[model samples]
Target: MRLIRISTNYPAYIQNFYGQRSALATQPYAQQYQTLMADCYSWADFWTQAFGKLGYEVWEPVGNAEPMQKMWAQENGVSYEPKTWLTDIVAAQVKQFQPDLVLVNDYATYSRSFFTHLRQICPSIRLVIGWCGAPYSGYENVFKAYDLVLSNIPSFVTDFRTQGHKCEHMHHAFNPAILKRIKQEQNTPIDFSFVGSIYRAHNFHNQREKLIKQLVAATDLRIWANMMQLSAAELKLLPLKQQVYDLVQLLKRLPLGQTVLPYLPKLKSYARMTNRPGLEQYVDPTIVARAAPAVFGLAMYQTLADSKMALNNHIDISKSYASNMRLYEATGVGTCLLTDGQDNLADIFEPDREVVTYTSAAEAIEKVNYLLDHEPERQQIAIAGQQRTLNCHTFDHRARYLDQLIKKNLA
Candidate 1:
């Protein structure tokens, strides 16, 4: 039993975090890392902490945090160089800890060679678990290396299984400590609020963007997100992008295509984008301009906590499943959530009792107005949702399930 969990934070949060704590950068690597994880930024140290609590010896390293890794290398006497994170840094950590299990939250970034190096350096390693929530087209062979694959989306589970890999479905959970960290007043200020992304005009986010636009036009909704606008030229070529993506995927499945197809750039990126210079035609750029900048970490929790009702919409790729962090995050922080309706929603929440759901934007608008006008019912649902999340949907529960899953396989 020892385990190592690999996770990273958003580049925006990393930059902001270090900016706010300039002195922290000068501290020892251990001290800098301790301060960094104290904010509980993203899922950075969550799995390690959760598994450690259950008496499993676990270590979590922020995988993509290069500055921190460099510090670790300096402190541990591990040599560092450019583009050697896989060869030098991570391999050294594996060789030192000799963990039995390695869980990669951002699995697509690394290749099979990285895992091979780990296996070579640490023969004690038993499982290579990967967490993939989005559709990654270019990382086909990268995924084939995982010992077990996990996704919150049921469809993704099916996709992994169809690709002839071992996969399981799990729901993302909330950290209740967020409540203690971010205090909320009794009287909430905002009537309705939304905190999410609207990156591109096509794919799952396109549906979310469309719904957000309709809701914003119809209701008094305040929004926050980090969005990038696509150029007019890119917008015009979206259809062509879709065609290219389809053709690539189709060819990848063919017997002949398996031999000679090289991965091309922008193959299916237009399908789901959060960065700049992509699909922006989905939503009116004016709304993006008017939107408050995206919130993260504790600020995001405080934002949701202060809102009377927070809206959540799943991406189109979710495909009839309620699979996203917002469900637990919004509800865990004590806000009435009005998310898009999905089949497994009731499995997680009692709908109307714990959370409210809507099938269409028009319906969401109608519910938003009614919830705004009626205070007692909305607060009641919010309270219940928070209770459900605190009681059942937490990293502790997830850790226990993971413990069992890993043990069964080990047995």
Candidate 2:
């Protein structure tokens, strides 16, 4: 069967590929930048590589140019309309490649009309599946355009199906080939580390801030924000806004601010900007000052491998279950995983044996300390976690599952 994988940053990948060869010869910094680019493209690269190994004729076309174009548009205060350029490119690829399936990892870039146009061009296309990383409340229309929708979150699958969409619970997996340990010296410097992006203040959902505050106070924790750039000027305003908000709250009890409290909504817009709240707020100032900038792709895996324990925290939206890529990536790299507790965690890893779970900030701190003290036990769990991931949760395992689902649907 023929398949065409649609990636959000294939254009950037292509540019980086050529750019690396020509510019990397003499520049020392070029190699580091190239590694970052590779990390950005690793998701799409994993699936393409996995399917190719299974003997499928996989063709990954640059389906969207947003990654390459967004920064320029943002800096100039302009908008990017994907439909203007993407539709023609995607239709042309469908017409020329005529693949049996078109798989999308980033569905937000493709509109309902774009898929309808692709269907018109190649009516023989068997299926179009999109992987969703979030809930489907506002995105039902987007999923309706696809024959199948896959999500790592189990609740999302149930929600999508209740809304009459064909959805499957496809859990996240690790690529052992991409994320293996490089030999490091016996002493790993970092005791505990957390690597992931912090959500914006507007979309705050998790208890990450609370956990980070406790951890920073208790242990030698390292945090790396997986963001492009965090503005120092914006961060400077947060405390002033927070102080004003606190004063306003204190005034509310005095009967004068109570009348003005209704107008607080108007002030909130300005207040939020000053607050600049997010994961940055909870992190200790010392840690934030010394924190290493974001690392991606191979460097991310290497970081996990070198750490004695890798911490995992799920966002608020993941309610009652853990569903983040870090669970697999950290454990797959043979690092002892210290993760938040979830009801379905045992379904993924045998907690306490393969992975360790924490219910509260105190527990997380206590476990981190205990695990750090007991090196042999921690190493045993890490080895077990890695073995379990290799046996049950690799990209090849997910690819095979997807292949079967496609064949069954086609048949």
Candidate 3:
């Protein structure tokens, strides 16, 4: 088996700044602190190299002009022209890699054009696959373009199949390396910790401040905004492009007090910004970049090693879907996670068994109290969740399953 996988946006470093158009842009404050980067790209690098072990060749488009960076930069006033467009470059990469299968992440707004160009170049490639999430609406058209579509949101798989498209449910997975990090750091203690975007929709910034004000008033609460790091002047004069070179320094966190004030006058507008509107052109690049795709890396480890219990509150937004890498990440790290229950969570673990759940602020506070009071039970739940992740949800498992799915679908 052979494959070419594509992702539109990923972090620059494990613990780097959020550049203007990147994830850092949305939550400028995250750049001020230490935020661990997710290792999805590392997963890509690992699995690609590991494919050789399975007697398959893999090629991924790497470097800056890689589709993700190029597309993101332009949208955020970072880069005007991407080094290469999807169709042309991918077609060339396919010819060079000579793979039997093609795997594409559902990042691009329009995937058909890319798939069509690829099929034109390599009609005998055997299979073309695209993994997707919600928004199965107009996707019936795109679904027909590929030989198969992998849906992480399994509930919608049957709907696509009904449209004469071959769709399958493939659950999300973690990387063992991250779990190892969790184990290594499980003993280290942190005060109060949270990892994710600070946008209004995801509510990373506001919720964090609220938590800090309440339970963590005296504790050391660290938020790794993971957005681009920038100076004071840059934050004030961003997107306007007043001084070209000076803005290049990059910035993340704005003073919490000052940042929220700007939003107070225009809470409605600011809230909408966090909600994520428009397409590649108008949408804030940082929202996509800084949110941390594999945000679970250090958070999981940190939650277990440093804190008594880690808080996982997803922003309530219309379009937002619970990424749940945090849920898996926290569990894998053996960190006691207290998250607002989301869709299909019970399928992953029993609410009070593998992980704990809460709906209201009072309940969340109560759960934290209960877990802290009962240390052994908390540890038991943590151990159970970690074992489950280690057994079934590592990135290695994801890659292996992906390989088999492609072969089976093609056959």
Candidate 4:
């Protein structure tokens, strides 16, 4: 059976990833696809490659690669709107490929109605499969579009089945071939680092941000994410954000508080810039000061390989599950992974042996310091963790399970 696998990138990464490839814009689609295949990011083509091994013809299309999409749209005579642009590209590809199943990895771009609309347009489409690892808070009926919904997070599967939707648990895995794509470091110089999302909308990013803030305060922790890019003016005002907050407290003590009330909103605005939640562009100041420029795809893998210990925290939605990509990526790349304590973590890696787990921010800090100081123990865990991932958590293993899942649904 032939199927299609679709992937999307963060708009920032799309710009960052492709903007560097200005020369590729003038090149043909085949060369563009060749360049795309070289950089192994988030699932990449691993799943479909695994599916290919299991004797299925799978076509993987990156829905957000604009240059390739533009060329294909022109060739296929497909017109698209801004909002529906991503799905438009995928639908056109489905029409071109004429596949039985179209698996969408990005739920943000396509909703239930869009999936419904896809089948309406592409009669060859027999199954619509979706994959999500984060909390899905769209319209209540959003998941109804898919014949099967898959998540690495055990909690997400539980939520889906509890809501009476058909869903399955598929753990996230690493592609060891990623190591071949990037240069290997003989020595890991960075002591502790984190390379993932810091956006507030992500399930537990704020809580993750809090833990990171504490870590930054106490340890030599470094972070890399493109989420917060403050302008010169914003950077100048960061220090003032605290002073403005202090001034507001001082003003509150004055008997003439009524007079300054008109300007309170202005003062509080700067305070919220560093302290409160709604400030989307800024992460915590401590992290902002320590934040390195974002790394993606192969750069991310290289960073993981160069770090002695990579920190991981689950989104609030993960709820006692150790299912995020970092669990596999960090360990697979042979870095000691110090992750938040999860109920199912032992199922994946033996505690204090294959990996390290921390129950609280204080414990995370304590364990991180302990691990960094004790290099032999840490390296042993790293070696064991990588072995565990290589043996059991590669995408090839996940592919056999996914193949069964797809066929069962088809049956």
Every model: Cα RMSD to truth: 6.8, 7.5, 11.8, 6.1
* Model 4 spans with C-alpha error above 4 angstroms: 77-84, 232-281
Lowest summed lDDT across 10 adjacent residues in model 1 is found at 270-279
* Candidate models: Cα lDDT each: 0.82, 0.72, 0.55, 0.82
* Tens-place lDDT digits, model 1, residues 1-411: 899876666777888888887777667878877777778667756776788898888877776666787788778999856866634777777778889999887766668888887898889999999998876777878777788888999999999999999888889999877788898889999889988787663445877777888877888889988677555787788677666666766766798765646444544453233343334344577566558878888888899999999999887788599999999999999999999889999899998899999998888988888988898999899999999999999999999998888987778
Name the candidate that leads on lDDT: 4
Reference-based TM-score of each model? 0.86, 0.76, 0.63, 0.86
Off by over 4 Å in 2: 9-42, 62-83, 135-137, 179-186, 201-205, 227-232, 235-287
What does candidate 3 score in Cα RMSD to the true structure?
Answer: 11.8
lDDT per residue (tens digit) for residues 328-402 in model 3: 666666666677676766776777787778765667667777776787887787778778878877766777777
Model 4 residue 226 CA deviation in Å: 3.4
The C-alpha stretches of model 1 lying farther than 4 A from their native spots are 230-283
Error of 2 at 290 (Å): 5.0
Which residue pairs show backbone clashes in model 1?
204-316
Higher lDDT: candidate 2 or 4?
4
Scored by Cα lDDT, where does model 4 land?
0.82
Q: Rate residue 39 of model 4 by lDDT.
A: 81
- Model 3 has how many clashing residue pairs? 28
**Predicted candidate 4 versus true structure: per-residue lDDT over 1-411, tens digit per residue:** 788888787777778778888888767776777677778867777867788888888888788888888777777788988776777887888888888988888877767787777777778888888888876677557678888999988877888899887899999899988878877676787999999988765665778888888999999998986556576786677667656677766666786864775676766564344343225646777788889888888889999999999999988777678888999999999999999889999989998899898988999989999988988999999999999999999989998988889889989
Relative to the unseen true structure, what is the C-alpha lDDT of residue 238 in candidate 4, on a scale of 0 to 100?
A: 64
> What total of clashing residue pairs does each candidate reach?
1, 0, 28, 1
